[model samples]
Target: MSPFYFGWLRWIMVYNSSIRYIDDSLFIDGIDLASIVRQVSTPTYIYSLKRVGENYRRIREAFAPLAAQIHFSVKANGNLAILRSLSRAGAGFDCVSAGEIDRCLRAGAPAQDIVFAGVGKTRAEIAFAVSAGIGWFNVENLAELHYINSSADDLGVDAVKVALRLNPQVTANTHPYMATGHGAAKFGLTADVIRDILTRQSDYPRLSIAGIHIHIGSQLGDTAATLAALDAALDLLAAHPRIRTINLGGGLPVAYRAHDAQPSLGDLVSELIPRLAGYDVLLEPGRSIVADAGLLVAELLYVKRQAGQVFYIIDASMAELIRPALYDAHHEVAPLRKTDREPVVAQVVGPVCESADVLARDRELPALQAGDHVALMTAGAYGMSMASNYNARPRPAEVVVSESGDNWRVSRRRETFDDLAQSDK
Candidate 1:
């Protein structure tokens, strides 16, 4: 294998073999990804209506028989266009921050359709949620319960709807940063402690117990893990009469690589729907519905050879998408130029000045060259939402293909250098 290869013939080969839909990658359609790289530059997020809609429809159809609702996790991808599209497709908002609530509202989602959640909400955020008449609050602690009650009293609003977030103390078996429901993650109130809350509800007058919410964790790769979490929550819910709505926090996993196996939402429903029987069900699905629906397209800037290893460095980096460095995550890569032969082992990295900035390690990838565009697949979830302006890098633009049509639209304008210093004196 050559240490470096970036010729026109090599480019054409990779382009032809990469995953294609209508001769375009899963997320790139109608709009020229190559042109976007030329005009707006790299490190951009591209969304596919076809792929996103498929995930949404699969979950909806799988859970349709049950009395359930899908609240798109705003923390996953807060793009207004993304939210609006999901909202239009019979989805509601699951917000952890007031900013997310505001984003949902701006996306034209009804206040009655948004559910507020998270551990640390400010007094101002509480008042904002109450004032906007958001559908429900997934309260984390007694202090929050009291604060919400006090805020509702001050606002002179009708009784506030709150769902006690109960922790089953079961391990979600995921990464620590993303796994929240385990013993001491500071997420939900313990299920036993929740028994006391039910006993003392009258102490908080302004708060009305509307439901029970429990989130096991995030990026949960196992369907059995989720079902186990659900059974635990149901056991807790069995004793509470006031609990009408049950929210199972979303951590459904999506396969970034083609061979990884993840259970369909129906598989989860098949096990859970039978258990719940007649209760109102709510799921806060952030990643699984959107992750595989997005792609981060960047052009190769240079190919470097060190010893026997090869490097395909791109214009995108941690400033544009941080999941790789932050979580040691893996995303499938494809060369824009298709090749006839199999792949070669190479390291794909970005221009970021850190050793951990590599996207893929010593992995087999199609030989790529300068001018050849590549995609980081399954980025629709934590990709752009977790992006930062670190190193003062300009963020990428997001283009969305229409669900009902074949045309694409720019959802977010690409960030520029001026954006970095615009607020500085």
Candidate 2:
């Protein structure tokens, strides 16, 4: 096969086949480049509602036999429209804070459909969650247990469903900063500690032990680490027959680069469903569900050549998307309009003051000039959620594209200078 065909096949193999080139310019679904640029403008996040639904159906079909409860992790995108889209499609939410729970509620998700997970839950946050009647609290420590119990007692509520997050000590082979299952990571409780708590379950009467939760880390491609963590949870459940649910926290990987070898959702479900035959299975998938469903479109400002390297600077910065600088993450950069010029190795950068603000290093792309539009691919997950007002750069707007790309709606408005300093004032 030719290189072009092989490359195309690789992308379709990992992500849903929604991206295509129209003439020379790239188009998402049935929408053309010029229309998106003219309508939404540049430096905006464009999400494909069709792609999100496709991903959701893919996972749902994979675990059809098991009826796994799929909770969309709010930390991935957290956009209200995106949350509402998933919620309307019959997906629950996996939240880590009161803020996230509020977002889910605003998105019209039922309180019973939300699961709260975090290493640290403040007393106020716990009280808020209790008042909201959230479904589950994946407790990480004894202190958190105390808080949940006390909060439930104060509200005069019945037993609050609790999932004990156990640290399996299984190491996921991803970035060290993203790993959460290792002994060094300050996430879940150790198995022995959880067992001791289980032994004294009567002490916290208002807290009901509903299940166990295990999350090794994010960006996990291989099944070994996740399966190992699940095995550890199953071992803990073997002695305790009362606990009926097992939550495999979200960390399914998405292909950022063409060469990424992340396993498919179908493969993961096939291997995992058999192991969780009798018990209830819950999956929290954030990145894999939405990462490829959106792209960040930015306007090219200038091109500079210095010391045998080319830098393509864009108006957007780390304040808008921080994955590249924060995690050294890879995001494919492509021109919005097709180009016939020869390809050149260039570094795509933002106008951030810090040196770590580079988006892509040593990327080969068609030669381009100023005013050209470029896109950062597979950025729907953490791109907007991690944005900040650093360097006083205003956050970009976001729009949701229809499945056919024929219609679009603005989900978030662009931030203004006044919006940035409003908190200070």
Candidate 3:
């Protein structure tokens, strides 16, 4: 186990599980990190095709008894290579925009298997989803319902199959920005409100009231909170006989460190199956399906040491990855090449200018040097997808590794400045 120590944050590794999917460890089916760094230097987004498949299998096995339709939430990680790999493994999609919908379709997901969802969907986006014959629209409010009905009617189609995303008035013990279950949040409607809408659904002939949907939160860990939300939804589903499907929205937690007590999806499925016996089950897992399977490889540009601090600046910035900047998210940080040092106090930061662009703050880990490699662990989901183009820095490139398979393919190439300014004209 690799022990890391810092003033405030230190990863005490009980077991040092080797980084997979990239060239970090020497294994029967692992890419060599030194080789990759030799080719693509620091700030590269590395994905493990093999681990992605394992994650999909884990979810599939979890909901095996029920006809679990696993929809990979694209908002987390929307790389075409990753999407195509999961699609080939029988994964559907939960999309939030027309561009995502189009990307899913291009990645080989059938329109009938995709679910379109978002709060502020535009008219053109609505038209585009309908035109694609998407299976369902997760309507967030009454106005969207009206817009969808009008759009479907204009397209001369039958009522579009839809699910009302229920905002279960419960507190998911997570960050406020990521939590959607709280009653006061603006994501979904309450039970009483959904009931009101169901009564009014009769007025809109172009809308098919098909299912009940609610996403409690993102990156949740407490079993009790998740089960409570599921039980609450089950109670509502049992009371309302018309609802044909029940979507226990995504947000299962993934392990950032090897010792993190992340529950198996099987445990969750086993506990919730009894309550959800008859209804068709829909699992919209985003993070659990891709988090561990990916890694963010950064090259150590320069290592500075002062009185009591060290700064390991890498090529990647918050503009290339936003979880650190947005949620103050914690991803395990480690030196790629083994180094000799008891431990040193250091901060793992990026090249971005903002003070909030910190990745790992106050940590004690082995010494790093210029041209060394460090990895940001548990970054598959929401890592690449949440990237921005701040500071005029182009996003980093992404690649995937598989066992006895393709080593690395450019999932997304870092854009050139000319490419960025091309659309301005």
lDDT of 1 by residue, 1-425 (tens): 45434422233212111125334333254455565566656767878766666777777777888867889898999988888888888789899899999999998999988999989999899999999999999999888988898888999976788888987777787777788878887888987878888889898888888788888888886676667767777787788755767888788877665556545566677788688886898888889888877889888898898989989888878777788888888887766545545466788888888887888788677666788888887788988998888777778889877775456667899887888889999
User: How does candidate 2 fare on TM-score?
Assistant: 0.95
lDDT by residue for model 3 (203-222), tens:
88988898988898988867
Query: CA lDDT of 234 in candidate 1?
Result: 78
How does candidate 2 score on lDDT? 0.87
Report the lDDT tens digits of candidate 2 across residue range 34-113. 57788768789989888888888887787787899999999999988889989999999999999999999999999999
Clash count, one per candidate: 11, 0, 10
TM-score of each: 0.91, 0.95, 0.92
Estimate every model's Cα lDDT from 0 to 1: 0.78, 0.87, 0.79
Model 1: number of backbone collisions? 11
Point out where model 1 deviates above 4 Å.
1-32, 340-342
